[model samples]
Target: MPPSADPSVSVTLAEIARIAGVGRAAVSNWRRRHDSFPAPVGGTDTSPQFALSQVEEWLRRQGKLDEVGGRERLWPEFEALGDRDAMGMAIAVTGARLGTAEAGHAGHAAGLLSETAPARLGTADAAVGIPVGISLSDAQRALVERAVSLARKQGAYETFDFLLGRWLDTHVRQIGVTPPPLADLMAEVAELSRDGEAGDVGTVLDPACGTGGLLLAAARRWAGSGSARTPLKILGQDIDPTQAALAAMRILLAGHLPERGDASWEVDVQAGNTLRADPHPGIRADVVLCNPPFNERDWGYEELATDTRWTYGLPPRTESELAWIQHALSRLSPGGTAVLLLPPGVASRRAGRRIRAALLRAGVLRAVVALPPGAAPPHSVALHLWVLRAPSGDGTELGRPVLLIDAADVRTEPSGGTQKTGRAAIDWPLLRKIVVSAVQTGGNGGNLPVGHVSVPLIELLDDEVDLTPARHVPKTTISTDLSLRRSWTRFGTLLHELRDLTATLSALELSTEEPAGQGTVTVGDLVRAGALTLRAGQQPADGAVRTGDAPTDSVPVLTVSDVLAGCGPSSWLPAYEVSAGEAAGTLTVTVPEEVVVVGAYRAFGAWVDTDAPTVLGPQLFVLRVDPTLLDPWFLAGCLRAPANARRAGTHTSTSSRIDVRRLQVLQVSLEEQRRYGETFRQLTAFERSLREAGAVGRELVDGLTNGLSAGRLPRDRR
Candidate 1:
């Protein structure tokens, strides 16, 4: 073991693969083929853990350590600490050191080594506001030094941001991050509401800040509006102490960014439950932006029933989001704006109706924008943004109108010839433009966007007082004549395609008599003989898979749903290919031509993928067959046969899952295999054509019914 190695630290196989910049399969292969491989120290046989010291020594001797990045090398050590809070503290310490060095405070480094270092580190400690009673170990201190060195090489801000992003990725389920697009949109909307203000934004607050994503976005917006030199004050509070500390470090570092100008910042972040304890009781900010936790029951409802913040009304126990809204309203100065991302239920839930009515009555609610799904956290639901303005304590604003805009249909079409999923990628740029325009124009009738409407406060103060934008926005009408003609044209094209497919299917010939019995082999046999290689798709870490349209750096992933449906990839994952002697951990296996992808659950099916370089998703099996030994299409067809499906299925009450190794395929000559493969391919095409025709047939019927009822088409049709 190396002198610095901690014998107590052990790493899982996945971590070892990440450390060596290889796949998990490669690590397993190493264990099987190499005699010098380290033995498992602990954990179950399926997921054995190896001592970090031994693994490090082995990698060093194998020359794999040469290409590993400094951050990747330190990650295992941090994970071995077995405490997320300590990992966060170590990150905070590293950020403090970087900030100190960047500001030319070399003397403070010595102070950090002393017993009173938290107090003597000066601005570094003041900036981060390190938590009390938490001290670093000797091993942790050494890790911090290495992190500081890395920051020096690759710009302090960049290195810190990378580390923070990775940390967020690891604990994605526990932390809810505001998606960048939504964050930017919220900032833009706030800016639009405050248009023509005399100077820069004075102060901004986020009660449930959650690492200060909203506040940071607000700062960027202010800087982009050419107010970079203006002084800004940011306040935040979170229940997690580590998050509060890290948020402080992020804001402090943002202030020093060269492109953001020399804006002096007064950042005050505290660790406590914001709803229970009001930290900034007396200060009113110019802007308040928040994306608070949803549906929380125990948000000090019992104890704080009479808390002065509930000016709108007493929020019910089930309406924690409403309480957050009122809390945001209380933090704003008169005429100041507060933009909050809230669940759609708060707009119309029975428990929140009273509070919603009170807000509309006060003329405080400015606009309600309905965003597309996948725009933010809880990506499956379409969330709403309530833009509220603290009334200036005047009766003149009592009868103001509220703008309602529904941009839920604003999304990008999937790219790279991939099939669409239930969720679509939000077109942030278009959404921003539609929303900003609607808010700026107050959604007046003239030339307003399709889903924009301006409703009077009196009109909205009905019995329910539902604030859902979709309910109020008028549905767009289609031209009867034009739609009828377009439907007819599409119907004709689909009929012609269907006819050709039917003719092709009819041309194929088959033998009437039963053929001689053929030899068969199991998939496991073929894999063992080197004629096929089976690879299981890995379940990506939470927040790692990108749904909808693929980004430039991402690749389409072939999911089990895609395999079962006989379609293309429905989602994407980041590509971590080795580039320029650097590896971004292990490279995900990209399916090549002739690869057979099989669905492992719900049903037994197979797809022969001709598209190369598609990443495989979880709950699927990729079978790469040797062309000399097996035909890919023939193998896929046999595996998908009903008899084989029944034999391989593991039956349960809900659904059937396939054991891919148990699937059987016929053994035949290559020429015979090619003949059957061609027929199978033709049948697949016919099935797709039938589905298309069915969809078009429905459209045709609907169009005819509407046209005849509306007198747009003559009933005689002579």
Candidate 2:
């Protein structure tokens, strides 16, 4: 229990449950049973909130304060800031103060200042003041000090990362955090610029630098081989001063943008609206990276309509993304490159077609890469990355074909138990390699991987310069004869397997008498008795850079989809390693003998017997059983029963959520459990065989029909 400072801040019941290390139901029980519990301070009747100070007092009296961390304790004050925007500003202010304090400790005067911050600090230098008009109370200021101390104890980079993540988590709806994979991909793709290859990307700029993630990524890329020759100059601007300050702090802490006194580093980060106010007007950079606000309806359309930056054409109000594209283009030095993350709609939006056509004809639009959904925030919508380079005076690479990469099918790490948070994990390193290779090869469409293609400039410069990668990229088409042959072979094998499984299923007999019931227990009970353990899988918090040091691409992640479909491993792999000293909640499976349950979907459980080491993905739960007391297969079979699923499930129109702890299990002797396990296994084999046969039968029909229609296989003329 840290000292209670603010009683004004309030928290939701869910947050209270999270802090207490108990289920939400437990918190509800407390409020209902205890008359002295804090009354509802805010929120609806369905989800009442409580004052943080009162809740802390209550928890302390109940001896539950020890369960919450100091970081967790600070969340109520943030939430108490009243609105999402205010919370964001508060976070930024705290981050700036933290940066300044770190700098002061290092004995520097200017010490990492954001343009938004007050030029001079008062005696209480560590105190953070939000620019969003909400002043922090004395108690709140003390809370910030404690957070800074914790952050300082951890490395500066680590502390900023933690704070940034928590901030994003607190306000995920109002803002978006670019997943590390996508950010890295953008940085790598930007690095394909001529200057980048020559190891002389001297300047980097991000107009819409959200927490400075893209800029930091660029900084890492520019510092080639960890010994970059050119001293990098970085510039960034954001609409929110708080976020801008946080971004400045993050970059400064990473040491990419050193303090003002440092000789090699030159950094200028301003807090103002990028679209409305040109913070770095007329400044050209070697490389530009931006993930601008998407579908901005009020992006100074009328005012900027005649601005000189609109070289292609006056962008329609509906096409603010195009405005950003042109803005990046205008900021580029001749032959300099810029990579911008845009929505898929921008490529073919009717309003932006003219601008797209113009850019394509001018040879400034180099490539369009389609990324899978969950590549970044707004996870459901697939996004596109446009790589552009300013035309040289001689126009050497102008007429070259544009590269189109359809990487929407790139693999992602499996969510251990559930698909809970963050974007769908991507094989970032592999995707980066694929995008870079395609760009360098002049979009040749030569020996390119499965989902990439290179199309001629003339082809793309048609009536509408539609640059949708999937539309241009060639789809793999096989000869009808070959398709039929493969389908027939697969069908034949499945039929044979089905026959054997049918016989085996028929031969297995159930005992006429029921085994004596040993007892009944809940999942929590078993866990308490040390007969089983429950573990949830890991996911990187919003904007997190790998849970630990392990690279996200190398680790295998078992996702909920894999468990439901009984597939091997999902394509997603976390950048972090399972064996690394990872932060808690980092999803990795170190144990094999466990039942992986899909807590959010239809399928509830499966016994994972695979040999590959895998991390558990989100929305998943793993139950590890003690072999001496319980049969793993039997427990899995019991959990899979429809009755158990029905009991645990809280169904809705679109999906269902299961609370595994509430599901009941029939306890029996280990030998009896084995008998049931064998029976269940045989039945499961029968079900799988039927499914395989059905799938193969459908494929066989489709292939035969297609083959006959295409005249690739002979058809009887009877």
Candidate 3:
């Protein structure tokens, strides 16, 4: 076990990399090459822990800490707190001290010396405060003092935001804070929907606010608007007290920032289950923005059965998102607008049909916009933005039509030409334009755009009040003749390419007679001979991998699916040392050039990756070969053979896993291997062309059939 003393706390390999200001791979190399490196004190073999004191001493003796900053050195200690909740509280406490210091409170600036419990700041003042009744451990106190000292050198807001950003990055999955782009988009949509006569949104509320992302977005939006001088009150509630405190501090710091300009903003974030207990129930806001928790089953259903907030109807027990929706609607004042980011299912789930009908009939729900996949959390599914308005108590708003905009197809093309897999990036600017324009003009008797539809209220009151935008938005089409011509042209080009590839493959001659003295060797022999190194991919560390298009600062991850499809990495993880260094948990990242093999049943394949550094995902094996000893392409080809697959496959009722080391390879000279590798490369290209041709052929047939059925094509003159 690691020592319990404060100075001898345990640290992971990842934390050591952070302290040394180097990549995890470097630390891994050090461990293997250096005799003086600290030994594991705890944790499992895969993620071994080392004593902090010994590691620090080793690093200092090696002169590795010379360029490391104080903040960087303190971070590992902060992370050592172990408990995420406690770490968050420590960060919040640090922010509070910085705020008090900025406010000229010397007593509070003494850094947690006084025993006075921290108080939650009221909404009336702009003071940043910590969570009430939370006490720091001795370890946390020492870390906070170091943090405060750093804060004094760097501005308080900058230091606090830096810590908070790092915390959010590490705990991304748990926190699920709204992406800044999505938050800004929501704020813009709300701003567009507001009534000009309301004299600017005086107040905003995020009932399910995680870390005040939406609130801050609103503040930035309104600060730049005509209402820049207006006082905006921000109210928020969360189940986690630490998150609530952090949210409050974040907003308070934003208010004091010089760039935010003398805008007066008040914020109060209460901690509790917003559904079970109503903290600000009596106060309605001019604007409400939320990215509520989705599909929660235990969201105070029985206790709030008769709650008056469900003006449309009591939400179904299974449809907790509906409850949040109704809560958002209830919190809207007369003519107030609310923009909610909800899963697409909430718009069309059967259980919420009645509530959907009620909202439509009462003209509360205004519009539903379908965002592209990867726009926000739960990124695999396309989420929706439901724009709603509180009834003004007049009948004039009752008969208005509901606008539906489907921007799900609006996505930026993948960055690299070779990247054929992975979620397409959401074209936020285009999405914003399409959605905002549609919302602003759809209800004003304007002709709906191609992806926009304006449906009457009575039309949605049918047996199923499905509000999914895809079901209602009309599909775009080209003129039949033009479409047919384009399809034919594409088909012809694909066929020409396929024909050339087939001819080239057919011209390749092979000896049908088998050699009597053929030599075969297993992959294990190559590794034993020091000709190759095999590393099995590991499950990435928690919160390491991100789904969707690769960001500029991220490295692509090669998954089993990507291997099977013979495509580039379908997912990516941030490449910054913070996350990337720990991406593969205990395994170092895949070597720059290697042959990657998938090991799943019926999905086994191998490919040579010559691209930039890529992280190997789980259930895969990376083979780094010595160029002089083995040809990577030749080895990949041999491993991908069907006969070799069966020979190495361990079959079960469910799956057939390939034992890569047991796979057989032909013993051949390097020159002969190069020749075989070239042939294999051509074969792979031929297969790809065949698949492309088949797809184009299908499109051609479908177009011709549709054109004929629609009587848009002339009959052939025989």
Leading candidate by TM-score: 3
True lDDT of residue 616, candidate 2? 69
lDDT of 2 by residue, 515-590 (tens): 5656668888899999988977666445432221122223445666765666445443332223231323344464
Overlapping backbone residue pairs in candidate 3 total: 0
Task: Give the Cα lDDT of each candidate.
Answer: 0.72, 0.68, 0.76
On the 0 to 100 scale, the lDDT of residue 543 in model 1 is 56
The estimated TM-scores of all candidates read: 0.76, 0.63, 0.81
Candidate closer to the true structure by TM-score (higher is better), 2 or 3: 3
Question: On residues 1-718, what C-alpha lDDT tens digit does candidate 1 reach at each position?
Answer: 1223678777777777877888889999989998898998875454477887788888888887644445566666766666777777777677766766755542433223121244323342223443344488877788777778767776787767777776775555567888877887887788778645625577888888887788788777664333455457778888887787678777766766778654456567777888998788998988899999998989888999999999988899899999999999899988888999998998888877888888888888989999887677676578899999888887655878889998877775544323323235666787887887888788863553347888898878888888899999863333334445665787678778778878988987788876787789999999999998987766665556555444444456667776556545666554332110012222235455455545454645676876555666666777888999888888888888877877877874327677888899898899999999988888777777677667767877886776666665545767
Model 2 C-alpha lDDT versus the unseen true structure: 0.68
User: Which pairs clash in the backbone of model 3?
Assistant: none
Q: Which candidate has the highest lDDT of all? A: 3
Runs in model 2 deviating more than 4 A are: 6-82, 111-117, 120-134, 195-197, 223-230, 256-264, 412-414, 417-425, 444-448, 476-718
- Name the better of 1 and 2 by TM-score: 1
Instruction: Write down the lDDT that model 3 would get.
Output: 0.76
